[model samples]
Target: MFRLVVACVLISVSLCDDLISVVVIYRHGDRTPIQPYPRDPYRNASYWPVGFGQLTNLGKQHHFQLGQWLRQRYGGFLSPHYSERDFYIRSTDVDRTLMSAEANLAGLYPPKADQVWDPTLPWQPIPVHTTPELEDNLLAMKKYCPKYNSLLTQLFKTEFFLNISRENRDLYAYLSKNSGAQIASLESLEYLYNTLYIESLNKFVLPDWTSGVYPEKMAPWARFSFATQCYTEELARLKTGPLFNEIVEHFRNATKNDGFRKFLVFSGHDVTIANVLNTMGAFEYHCPPYASTIMFELRRNSSFYLNIFYKNSTQVQKIALKGCDFDCDFDDFIRILKPVLITRKQWDLECQNSNFGDFNTIFIYSSIAIGFLISISLLWVIIACFKQVKTNSNDYTRLAIDEVA
Candidate 1:
């Protein structure tokens, strides 16, 4: 029994040392409400010092702590000093996300040795890449997708959602009267809920009208909206598919190259995190808190494997893939996610509601066919004119010969 226990311990230690790379997708930390309802008491800009939709000091601190947690988790694997080759960070083109990434990096890679430019400052500048929201389909996913929009429209009209709206008519009417904004749709209701939730979190006294239905009555419907973006397989494919596919590619690349990047970080919104979780079928329908994160670790033990973890608060818990175990084989992980994974080209084509390449090919062929027909008609006309002229000349020659005779 003693010998067996020693052998198992040795095997466990070996497996623990096999981590190759990690991908982290995390929400930006807490911020002021996006916007206030028409009747909101805290509507003044002074209430939020950083203006609307910007990160707060509290938010920066939350991300800094999260970064510290990351350092603790990856200290053994990552280099002590910042290295561009080993780490890549991307954030949504939003002020909050950009600032959050900066704050996180401050904690994760504090200046060391020659990296310390200032004796008093412990932080180092790290590059965080971003794309315009209009064109970003990977993290922000704000790029207009016609098919996705059409699906969303269809979803709202479906029996399930229509019933939800019908049942909430009274709630909507009450909220509209109190908040002085239309709250008929789940999306609008969710916005109101978020503002109120943020205000409540900041210890701002809510109006008396909200006491009855502030949280208990409205929370479920608000949370439901988070899942709707990637609720269906088709929606998931068009919405979060590109991000998932990109993460998979990173893991595959790591397998191929020994010197590949060690860590990739994405700073985004709660919706970004929720969409990914829902698409993966591991979401539990709560608003992902500030600085919440989902991590994907690629490991090699006899063979490559994947481990996913979710950190919403103080604790980090291992989350199994919907149909796989905690330590899932890499091949099995890919096979299970095949249904929702999509390439950038596929996403682009699907978003537009048609295969544009095929459409362009057909257009080119049609133009060529039309040009060929026109050329054929011109050639026939030319031949006819030549034949007529030859016939006239022959007649004229015959007439001349007769006259001479």
Candidate 2:
């Protein structure tokens, strides 16, 4: 055991020495529930101090701590002064995630030199890039993709889902009765748990039924549901392909992009972390805790290598890839991901047509066919009316000639 520990430490040191770039994807910190169950006591946004889905002071502190940890881990490697050229940050356009990134940056880079505008405040503003919430496809899972939706429907009917649901039937019944909402499915049950967990965390008194076994059982159920949602090779690829593609693109372009930043930070949700981890075969059965993070460091070993590290709440562990070691060759990593990874263009195409069916193309063809039939009918009507008018005029002429004779 002692030798093993020492060897692990030496390997970590070697990897750190060769580290060339990093990408950190993290969940936003604690926040008020985005919504509440129908029968919950705290259904209104007014119940929380920060309103619905906004970050609280505690959340700020959580992210601030995370930022400080990042600094401690990479401070020696990063420039002492904050540089736009050295670091880049992006987050979901939502309030909590965007705020979390800002809070994190506050801890990551404090004011230095003439950068200090006011001695009273040690913090400085850092720009975070984001698209409008409606247009956002990377972090927020709200983007509408018909193919993904269809795939998810098919997933729910698979044997895996059936087995898990059968096993948890009793738990589902209990949750439905006690969770103050009708739990129609595992996804609905998860919503109830999320509300209960957040409300309880905010010091709201939970119902007597949720005291002990309920939470324990519900936690696993939640993880199982989440895992089933994206565990399959195909499901993970479709749901998280864009994010995976973005990370790889950043790494691949590191050499070509001018003034390449050493760090790329993504502030996102628990789903984001879980799905990405699942794709890499590094997922834990537990749902990622608030402020959880996964760090992928690209290192220049004999050949370039990718080292993936996962942190849940506090403990950070090295995650071995499915087909490779913990520190896998970058080329090998890319090859392993090739089947799952997709380009932005391919993603758009898949969204329109998943090969199962092309709804967009079908809709277009159906519209054209309907339009052609309508045009032909209108032309026939016009020709018939013109012939009737000419026939009436000729009859009138014949009557006039008879009267003149």
Candidate 3:
């Protein structure tokens, strides 16, 4: 049976035709938890080497291995020597993600001959581009979108989410009391799970309360909560739109220009991966694991087509966009994704009008300034009137004394 399956796979690849270009979006590898629970015993920064929320040596290795895998898989497509024109890399403005991109680039492109600056160092520095964290919308996590938040508020009020919230009420209360957090939400659970997961990996002994069935129950809800955040079509469009537009443009350009670049690499967080996958209508229920990747391959057979592959952790699975087959045709793929392509105006408006109250802040400051000016003018008028009254009174007293003389 194994031989037969292998034979079929080989035959399918043989029939699939030529690879033109590749775009990959991947999650950064394992790292120290970004933060600890408020009441956790190990809350001190002294416990970690680089302090809170930094990538560990293990995370570096994970990304390095991924780079090697990319090298192995795309060896036939990419040039043996690195060319500035052939490859591009972008990462989120975070230490872990930036470092991961550099590590991955190291595996993808190693120094050779003239490209080597030093005889001792085998690796060469590859540039990874990034924007400011506050300005990032492509990654979707830290972006403040009022429209998206409004959608989430409505979603939370739905019967579906209400049931989930009510069912997990006891669990949330227990977590809040133990973790020293007020009003535990889905985000809190995610952070809590991350802490526990990382601690367990580090060989720390967890409390007996998390021993067997408790963790099992908590894990699913946490994952479900994350998935629910962008569950709706509108929310998904708003959150994932920028990224989807970029990927589609890359595909379109690759086809139009006959594959301008060999590889377009994006290094980002798990939320980044989930948002893109969800936008494609290919997302599974679980949260995206560390070091996961989704690849879009532009292939040219009789004409241009796209092949989408997802690696959740270890295995690569093929996924299709909605209204398209596994190996989606270029035209059909473009049409299906058209509605979610983020416009420049829409993104700017969302960023400018986020739920954090940009308009309200301007109004409040302006109102205070205006009120202060009006009060100053009123005080000046009253002082001037009092001085005039005193002058008139003095003149009248002098006139009376002269008449009496």
Candidate 4:
């Protein structure tokens, strides 16, 4: 293990002639939740001005720094001057992800020559192509990450049961009104919220609305479903997205690929970063916290052999992968790549959810359940009134009728 690591270190320390292209998959900066549940402690919107889980200004700086590092690392390959042909970027159409790409480009390119504006103006916009989250080009889902699936199946199975719950249905009305969405379930709610802010940044706030404490009595899938949705969205996207195909084609036609793509930056979420590594056969990285990024460093050996170094961009900087020597065989690399992404959720389970206890979980979940039920009951009572029901199809109308009728 140590020898392999040494080899990776050596690879990072030098450049190889065989190194032609780079693919960097990165996570977007910090963000807040889309909004708080009415029961949430942080629901008051004061919890975050950008509002829970949205990117802060600090995150912008981080990407800018990374961009500078990239410019320094691949000095010659990329043009000092702006040419549309020189660099290409892609994001997941999320606000933070796309914006981070823009930030990184700002630092990397620095708006050379005619690209620069007034002395006061800064950070020229760089193009970062993207597709919808469900339609993102580079994505994968491992069919068999035991822990992730265990949590997932539990989540899905639990959500199936939640559909029958009175509380969930009632709460849906209140949230639906606020979000202008029909959030029938947690996954739907999460998707609605995740995309809304990812696409419309200024409209939302960033830490998120999570109270960091769920209600005391939680429903079976209440906690699990949100987690599952977060995990599964990437998986579903990967299999169907164009990114994997793009990689396959890129390797197939190496000489035509751009050298200036020193880093194949992918601005996405932690789940995205984790799955990309897992898809590529580095099944060891599990992401924790918001804006977690997994780094894949590609370099050439002394003998001009190709290699890879996998790092999770975190405080400890976990090395889940070592020298992935392709030995000039793209086929070998793809084989490794496919499995790593496929099983990423398993690694995430290890890195993030390995040590949960019954007592704390029970307390947390119970509190959530109690809060959810109370709010739901309030909505339900409002919905239950006949006078409003007779005049309108809207749940909000019924809620209003409760007081009048």
Candidate 5:
């Protein structure tokens, strides 16, 4: 078995020539919502000092941990220093996404003698190229889901669109907003404010029961759409635009022809991951986690492999990120890519205790619970004794008054 496995590995390595390129698109870490509608549960601006949709300290740490993971996972794949001949990164122009790429870079490429943080440490700022917001990014979505756009064209007009109104209040709030556009409801002719007045008759309620609806799914769609679009666009930007079709060419070439980069990483969100896979007919029930990463490795004579891993740690755990194959053609290599959710605690626990047939988790949990109960009981007893003493003092004072009388 060992000999056979070694032979198989050698056969796989000989397949591709030297031609490596990688495109990683990921969402910025956890951020405050950009803004909430007037009726939103958490609409107060003070809810987030950064004023919504901005990266928080936690978000930074999440990406920072991922950066460390990448450094370990792909030590030589990416350079510690910037080089014109290798490596390219792009993000949507939004502050959060842009900053996410930067944070990831800080981990991927730590400071060097030439690249220092302010004159103290050598850390250089790597650039993240961006694109215009509204442009169609079918290319980006194609990364994980090649079939998403065509699927979107189908999903766009489905009854599903009407079902998305519940959580989104942007629909009504935008109305009478900007002091523009006539606003009206079907049953009652109401005051016109945003374009909804003209569009409401044309528009029906979204899936959500809430009156305020801009199609809640669409708001999220745009957010993820941009994430997916960047992947394809960023790859193409490295060479030429969509016209050159560098994105597909690169993947196909990497897997079919030459041995491109040792490993390719694309950091992006669950939606982008979902949509791209949806488009490519890669259906994953798993929504991409924050700081989630998708990896592609080309192997054995034009054969390709894909695996996805998520990061949710402040420090590196001494375990490897798992992988799954991309759902391509069977004769061509299409297989099931099951969805999985990995948390830091679970991942850490998995690493520390990998022994099969052992019930360490169960024992650990039970022990912790029993210890907690004991501590609680001791505190309760101490409080009860104090209350009893106070009551006795009051009773004793009354008895002494009776004796004096």
Candidate 6:
């Protein structure tokens, strides 16, 4: 009986899955609106202490709490002290994202003993890398991709979006009149909605006109607008592909024992979270709240497996990929996402290609290419002629010298 009980305990231990690595992508904490609409009552910088779109004290607290929760959840897996080899962090170039990462790090790796730089402050600096927003294709997704813009424009012109625009024409006109801004498309409407939502969250009294359709009528459209950025497979490939590809590469590296890093953190915006969730086919139409996080955990029992989680509220809920189980085999996870997984080279090619129903773009590129070729050919001909002329000149000189001799 003792031997049997011991055997059962060992078997149970062997069957349990062990988490090996984690990748967390999260939205920045709360912030003031990016910009006020034309007629916003609280448009003055005085109303927002830190000015436009900057993270607030509340935002700092939110991220610090989130970091604490992360430390609690991953205490066993992660090192107690900050180690460059064990953890990595990256944020978009935006000030809010950068500040949020710093606040989160303050909680995640609070100084202890010899690591303490300032004992009074109880905090230590940790590196958070970033690229310029315009050049960042990985996190910000703001890199200029003409093809992506072209695809989005085409998507807006589709019958479904057209119908939505026609249906919301009255609402758009009403908003435009009240806000003193042109609210024509869902995109424009979403921007207004976001500003108003942020103002409301900050306890600013909204104008009377907002009562008619502030959230009830406009919220759905605003949430749906997030979906439009990555509505199609092509858009997903261009928008979220680089980040997802990087995540998968990290997992692959861990499986092969190629990298020592076990924790990766990405601080970005709501749209960043939305894009990732949408690409994973797990997004539902709702604004990802401030400081919301998506975790990709790699674990091993006998073989490797993946478990995805979303923490929008206090609870972190398991989110399975569409057509995949909650605890999915690593190989199966890769196979399922293979269709959406895009390499950096493929993303670049797709972004530069004008094959997506944009004849004008195609014509412009073709003209550039033809002009380049023609210019090169003309230069080559000119150089050849000059060389031939010099050769003839040399021959004539040699002939004259022979006659003289």
Candidate 3 lDDT over 1-405, as tens digits, reads 324433433344333337778899999988887888787667788877676777788888888889988887777678768887999988999999998998888888888878899888779988889988867777634666767777788888999878878987888887777678763567777778878888888887776666642468778876765576568777776777777778778878887885577788999988787777777787776778888999888877667778788888888888789789866889888889877778646776764554445677867877999999999999999999999999988874355447653
Global lDDT scores for all candidate models: 0.88, 0.80, 0.78, 0.52, 0.45, 0.86
What is the lDDT for 155 in model 3? 87
* lDDT tens per residue, model 1, 89-195: 99999999999999999999999999999999998889999999999999899998988888888888999988998999999999999999999998899999999
Give the 10-residue window scoring lowest on summed lDDT in candidate 3: 8-17
- By lDDT, the candidates rank as 1, 6, 2, 3, 4, 5
Clashing pairs in 2: none
Task: Indicate the residue-level lDDT of 281 in model 2.
Answer: 83
Q: Give the TM-score (vs. native) of candidate 3.
A: 0.82
- How many times do residue backbones clash in model 5? 55
Candidate 4 lDDT over residue span 1-405, tens digit each? 336645544444333234555666667765666554444344566646575656778778778877776676556555667566545667776788777888888888886668788667776766778766543334423233334445555555665555644556655565565555566766565444454334334433333322121122222334234333334434333332345555544444444444444445667766665444444444442333344555443333342223444434434243433245434345445544443333334343442432344447856977999999999998888887866777676535356447753
- What candidate 5 gets wrong by more than 4 Å, as runs, is 1-22, 117-119, 136-246, 252-269, 301-405
In candidate 6 the C-alpha lDDT for residue 321 amounts to 86
* Lowest-sum lDDT 10-residue window in model 1: 6-15
Clashing pairs in 6: none
TM-scores of the candidates are 0.85, 0.85, 0.82, 0.54, 0.49, 0.86
Model 1 residue-pair collision total: 0
- Compared with the true structure, the alpha-carbon lDDT of candidate 4 equals 0.52
Best by TM-score: 6
Positional deviation of residue 304's Cα in model 6 after best superposition, in angstroms: 0.7
What CA root-mean-square deviation does each model show from the true structure? 6.5, 4.3, 6.3, 18.6, 25.8, 6.5
